[model samples]
Target: MAVRARAARTGVYQYAGREIDPDNTHGLRDTAVVNVLRDESAVFDERAVRSFIGKPITDDHPSQPVTADNWRTHARGTIMGAMRDGEYLAFDLMLTDAPTVAKVNAGKRELSNGYACDVEIGDFTAPDGTKCQARQKPGSIIGNHVALVDRGRAGSDCAICDALPSNLFDTLKTEKPVKTMVIDGLTVDMANADTAIATVQTLIAARDAATGKVTTLEAQTVADAATLVAKDAEIAKLTKALADAKPTLQQLRDAGKAFAVIEAKAKANGVAVTDAMDEAAIMKAVVDKAMPGNTYEGEHVRIAFDALTKDTKVDQPKVQPIGAPAQITDAHTDYLNDRAKQRAALSSAWKTPFNAADAA
Candidate 1:
């Protein structure tokens, strides 16, 4: 075969305006290192190489060694050995055992197109009538256990077991039952096919039993029930407290009326009574309005009242007269005055009106 003239001793060449010398030793290197940029279909062989370099080499057009890009396709078969001389830079190309690369490309394609092949299942066997170990088409079968190997395929150093989909299994179940099997160089049991079937059945039963014990939905229902019970208990406790306090609230209502009467008298006199005023304000107002004689000013009110009536009932209902006001303005004024007097009197009292004894 006619070989192309070897590249310049410098091995450094310009391509697309960029100077490149592989490994930076162009001065010592006698041959050039040129990359192959041929498409997969380009044929590279002896005759192909001669045809490419038919023109005579010249000063302006020096002979360029056959780089992988311009080499005949067949040159790939011996590219590895050719690298020893550094005469050419060609890729040692082969498609054998390249499933991982295929898988990566397939993932990219799937992501771009939003489509994927459904998984298939089936039993795979080897050429020697044995099961092949997992490795591409040479490895796992996608959905079915069946593999289709065309004639003259190479690279049988590794094999593998591929799981196929159930649909494919239904179709291939009667295909001679795939008699040969291998697990890491171990043979399948010859007389224990029945045991294998039983083992699968036992595993199925155990999984079902586990699924029946506690389900996600059931757990959610249990949590909801606990929350409802707690809320109902809280509501019932509040209801009981309100029921127990009803009578005491009613008693305070009755006692608050007598205080309101005294408050009305103080307001009628143009005095600005306040809620902060104590029992002293009430006694003062009563003494001022009554303008009691020396018999009352020097003497305590309790003693004067006691002398006036010995049979006075201390616990008489002290309801304020309902005719205190007819209009809203009058009612508001009455409320303000009454609150002021109540605050003062209650402040002076040893106990608050809210206390149990005061309510009684």
Candidate 2:
């Protein structure tokens, strides 16, 4: 509860006329706080001033209003009347209640004025170059009562506002600086600029990280494609090598069989053959032994082999007689071999040169 004073020039209350320092510990505003001239005019208006005149003074404000009906029970004095005193609207009062006068005479003399008003909230510099957050609007000020207290807010010197600032507002809103943000061509209202900026920065960092991952994946894809191409080329090369080897393998098998025949013919012709002898040397030996006096190119050695084997082929039986059995008998088998020389000559016939074309 704010207090007031009882004095001759400064009785209980005044309007306009309240001043609070910016550096005051109350922390009301950032500059000297005062009422506007227009609001002062309203406070001193005939109806407003009359409402204050003759109002009761109490030891302290009652819980309810002290009207004419209740003044006898609550009044310690009376706010007799008021008038303009320089920039201030000063009041006069009469202390009629004995007990309250005793308290004041006993040095408890501070005063408080109780009033009602509709506060108009704003920030503005006062006529004396002070700042205030609010002032009483025109025609909205009315006097209720005055009270004597231990301490006064707006002293007789009018150094503070009269109304209880703590209860003046319907809802107290602690003001914070408003900030704005622009996103995708739209403006957004924000309570904190620093937090918004930090959030945007975090989002940008996340986007960059995702972009880096995509770039790495793209590069990896290209490398994988190149590796696949190399693998395909290697597979193609191996396939071609296999294809080129097919005919060479057939030729190698044919040459090995030809040499085996030459070695057989050389032994049959009584030309000494040894493991150390190659196909060409064995062929020459066979030719020299069979022709006895001829010296010929290596190709002529085949004539000697044909001459030696001409009499060796077994002929088919003349024609099976009507009575002959379909399965072979010992007599038929006997015609296939000279039993006495079979063991010695069998390898020669079995290793004979094969004609792949005739078999196919």
Candidate 3:
């Protein structure tokens, strides 16, 4: 493994370009002393930098050293987001367990890193030009976990921060009163005032457009409901009318059937009915065809039509055809001869004179 280069250090951390304030009682000799122990700085050499970069963050240092086999059971979260704040490695701790988060929020602010290294007791100079008695072997440093504690080995300098130091933002020079707005639960703090205003306006316009579409949908729903009510009322009225007229329909059907039968019988017997005739006219024609010369009126026409029903053969009445006649019978020839002799004797008596017949 190659030795890695470390970041430069200044032996103390500041609230960086911000004004210093005095603490009431947080256990510190000075107000801004983030001391990284000037003489014994070998703990943060190049070996420590590589080993501690991606270590896990825990509530407290476990009794046993954390390893890959047991890290899952011991790890609350990782502190891989380590930034070198001078000689002290400033890392962010996010406890995965709810109880640990509550404890940290309730004033557990200090952090201590648990690591193993081969310390060679000798007169040696650290990479930052700080002379020290114990020097850690370049390849013998191994990081386990950075733990939250009541007080760290490095004092309050290695601690959890409630908020970022104000000096991190060099853009606070603007005189815009430092505006802050929230969009969908996200706080929007920008460097430029004009950019912030434009963002707020665009978000508000999108919200208003969504509200308008919701209103349109609600109005369309009401209109569809009203149309359904009117259609239901029309259907109900039609259904009732149909029910009320049901009683008379059977009688009308029976009359229609009888009329059809009479018309059919007349047509079969050589009568042609046309649409020009009404019901009564057609019935009268039917009666005339059946009886040839008889006529009926009033209710008697109906009675005559009923009598013809018992005999459908009235439609086929016998009649002589116009063709050569057949020979006459013997009885019919004798009767014709007797009628001629009587007519001859009556003529002779009249010729003998009425005076001579009286004297005899």
Candidate 4:
């Protein structure tokens, strides 16, 4: 069988660790042999065909750096065996097939994993009024309302909701208009807190009544309600305070002054500030103003660079060195003069002189 022969020769043969033979263990079938016999002209021209025909085939070895356009066509079935059924093949292999494989892969990955929604349930409806479904995707048709489903099992309904975003489910649970609110330092227009509170209150009330301790819970509920009222009053007061404090020039100046004070403190402590402040210039200015030049003036004495470099005038006459008087003896002076003449000539000749020169 031509297929069997080709597969035996080419499938998965590794010079190193790289799979050379791309076709799986299944070699050429009888059909391929029949095709080759039927179309001798086409078969003769193909390089893969020549290799199969037992001719001398040139195997241009593959490397990681080789260009994809020039990559050898590998066996199709063999590649499938290496990868998962549904998972994508890596671009490292596909760079040979299509140079844009990476881009295509990126698009596919985005479609598969990136498009997300936190849909909130608005309502549930069914034809029979028995089985109902809630649309809970946040930006979906309906949002932030509870969908009452009568027919579906609670577990199934909950599971379906779980498959949706956590945020959407949470939003649905707290279904109402999102009023602007602050928690910690962050500004948020979150899901309605009132709806959530009412829902919780209703649940608690129902549970207490069913358990026959409604009267006992009544006292706790009153206490909780009082506490909540106090909290609301406090929040309202703060909100009013914030609202009253409108942006003014004076307020801005006060903020700037406060910032300056903090900045000064930071600089004094040698805290590293950003380039916005020009720390180098500020430091130079500080040095120039606070500790300019190497001069120290104490309480009793003043010291400065002028004191060191200033010219001093002496109050006494200059004295010359006392030595023997110069008396020229003809023999000694002439010998010295001759020696000087010879030394000068020698000095001029060599461009330098030794300690003593030869006397004429």
lDDT-wise, the better of 3 and 4 is 3
* Deviation from native of the Cα of residue 347 in model 2, angstroms: 99
Query: What tens-digit string does per-residue lDDT give for candidate 3 at 1-360?
Result: 011112223242222111121121223324343222222244455666567665666778776676544565776655534556655565544344567778777988677778775544445554567654334455565777888789765567667756633542364456656567566775677655677767766776888799667655644554454346556766787898887677577878776666677777667657789988766777788778776776456555776666554456433234678899886769778888888898888878767757866798
- As a TM-score, model 2 comes out at 0.33
Better of 1 and 2 by lDDT: 2
Clashes of 1: 36
Better of 3 and 4 by TM-score: 3
User: What ranges in model 1 sit over 4 Å off?
Assistant: 1-172, 176-192, 216-360
Q: Candidate 1 residues 1-360, lDDT tens each?
A: 011111111111112211122122333123333221211111223332223221111111112332223323212111111111133312221111134224323431110000112211123343334432111121111110111121101112111112243642244244366554553354544246675455545555776677555443443444455346556766787899888676686677765775665555455544467888754565565455444343343335533333333432344445587776665567889999999999999788876346777577
lDDT digits (tens) for residues 58-101 of candidate 2: 88767667654455578766565677765556666656556776
Question: How many times do residue backbones clash in model 4?
Answer: 10
lDDT per model vs. reference: 0.34, 0.59, 0.58, 0.31
Candidate 4 overall Cα lDDT vs. reference?
A: 0.31
Best by TM-score: 3
True-structure Cα RMSD, model 2:
52.3
* Candidate 4 residue-wise lDDT, 272-353, digit = tens: 5565764334344333343445223221011221222133232332468889989757888899999999988877886655
